[model samples]
Target: MTNLSLQAVKKAFGPVEVLHGIDLEIAAGEFVVFVGPSGCGKSTMLRLIAGLEEITSGTLEIGGEIANSLPPAERGIAMVFQSYALYPHMTVYDNMAFGLKISGMAKPEIDQRVRRAADMLQLTPYLDRHPKKLSGGQRQRVAIGRAVTRDPKVFLFDEPLSNLDAALRVATRIEIANLKEAMPDATMVYVTHDQVEAMTLADRIVVFNDGHIEQVGTPLELYTQPANLFVARFIGSPAMNIIPFDVLKGGDRPALLIKGVSETVVSLGPDDKICAGGTGYLGIRPEHLRVARDGDMALEGAVLVSERLGELTNIHLDIGQDDPLIIKVPGMIAPRRGEKMKVTFDRENIHLFEAEGLAV
Candidate 1:
């Protein structure tokens, strides 16, 4: 019942429109992550829900009630910004209790809520310490504790872990995951450009591009079956290798062929029918391909670059195409650069897309 729903929400600054009409419904307790490259409007959409930005048109509903005109404080939502936003001079307890105190909650009640949040975040040991005295992770916890004390129906996070070191980011990410579990009924919406964060934390992810949601799905869903070349190229590390070609021109029934791979073919039906001899892109993830034997669609490619990371060897194949193909070879069997190798992938694993970037 604590869900958030956006009905054709839009935003504009003067004449420049920042977000096209966006429609999304977030269920109660769902952990949704907004992910996209810079200037993609993911953060702007988050701000729209936080009431930080006014909606130029359309409705925003929290718990089924229209809240477009509702101020942030009145919307019963607490936002944790990327900056942590804690008072440097104040003790952790005081920082956490500040909001309740300012709102004229009973002094005893404020103390009780702060203590509860401290226990939840394990901030009790550092309650008396100032923000400057705490590590980046601890101070960020205090920032979250502040929001926890307010006990808002929904929690909005704006890249809260970007400031931490690598080790601390991992630790804090786990802690935030635990926090979500502790408040299962509290709807949470997080915004991040980091794919790892999106993959690990989101129940569902919203992918944005050019001020519109390109796709929305679970992490695995987005990673495996991207809607288009943009998403196929964006979701994974090193990205999916895209080799563009003319499908229908190559053969019968509008089949897709992988050049450089000797005769590896994926026959497409009417659903994937390409304009006869028209162009399309062939996409395959690095992990799904190998440097060994290939079937009918196998190709011989030159290893333009090789990256050995102890656990795995990433072979970037200069497959005589515009889009350099990358194949993730399992284990540490290093392949030398400039060496010729046959790259293979299963037919089912191949993704076909039309000239317009729509999946076929």
Candidate 2:
């Protein structure tokens, strides 16, 4: 079935543990992406699944078989590494056929597979060209072609597009997405640091942090309803704004007090567990804040920087916080540098983080 399952999977190198008791499942044919910052163990988890690294404890199963002890080749999996790892001396055709030839596949069958894979990756024209003669995207496609020749039940991609330029990255991402469509039954696991890649390519994204999974959900779920402060800050561009504020006691409802040029108190969730007079963080995305209107909760700040990008503008505001608050205004609006302004956010869009950064 090519489904993968991990039962309390843990990995260690000598005395140091990287992945800690991770439990997950991937349905057959699902395109799952592991995403996180560098050193967050996303790649480590991918390596473990690929059998490139051993699991120090627990079990790993692929297609309903115990595969923890299986060598990578025996596990019916193929990996495309970050570095092309191609033999510069060999032509694309030879590179794609090398593994099949070594495995004693008939020349006719190897040729058939290579040609079909090349056609799928649109690398048919470059089949006779050597690695050094091909562009970055062509070389990557050749690598993918080599993997396809193996006819693996599972495919593992470790940041395959990171080495490409911006244009090539986009083109190759579309290629990978199309590849998944072409081979719907082949399970693929991709690891990347780019959230856009995770959002676009993944059926489900596993967000990793500090050697643990912070959250697992579709892109929209993670964007709209982050589980904790770490995820709220990590998933979005310019990040969600975090401002610490105090709560007032002896009120019918809780209120968040934001202090800028003026102190402003805004009402919070009626059912939240946060006690009155306690302190917590108020979280809002840059796109959520708007120019203050009459009777709106306003915080005064001066623009530190305004970045106009044709259709949208990003402004950095110094609101007496540890970090400058960023506000994103759509279309043709640039507040001048050092211009004082008042920004307000809809209460419904605000997020509350209680003590220990737990979302309320």
Which residue pairs overlap in candidate 2's backbone?
none
TM-score of 2: 0.95
Q: Candidate 2 lDDT, tens digit per residue, 1-360?
A: 499999899988899998889989999999999888789887788888888899999999999999998998788899998898898899999999999999999999999999999999999898888999988988998999899999999999999999999899999999999999999999999998777898899998888887888888888888888888998998888799988888777789977787766788887678765633388888899999999988887987999999888989999999988889999999978888899988999887888787678777
lDDT value, residue 178 of candidate 2:
92
Residue-wise C-alpha lDDT for candidate 1, range 243-280, written one tens digit per residue: 77766453556576655544455576656555333677
Could you give me the TM-score of model 1 versus the true structure? Answer: 0.93
- lDDT at position 66, candidate 1: 91
The TM-scores of all predictions, comma-separated, are 0.93, 0.95
Provide the RMSD of all predictions against the true structure, rounded to 1 decimal. 2.3, 1.8
- lDDT at 331, model 1: 86
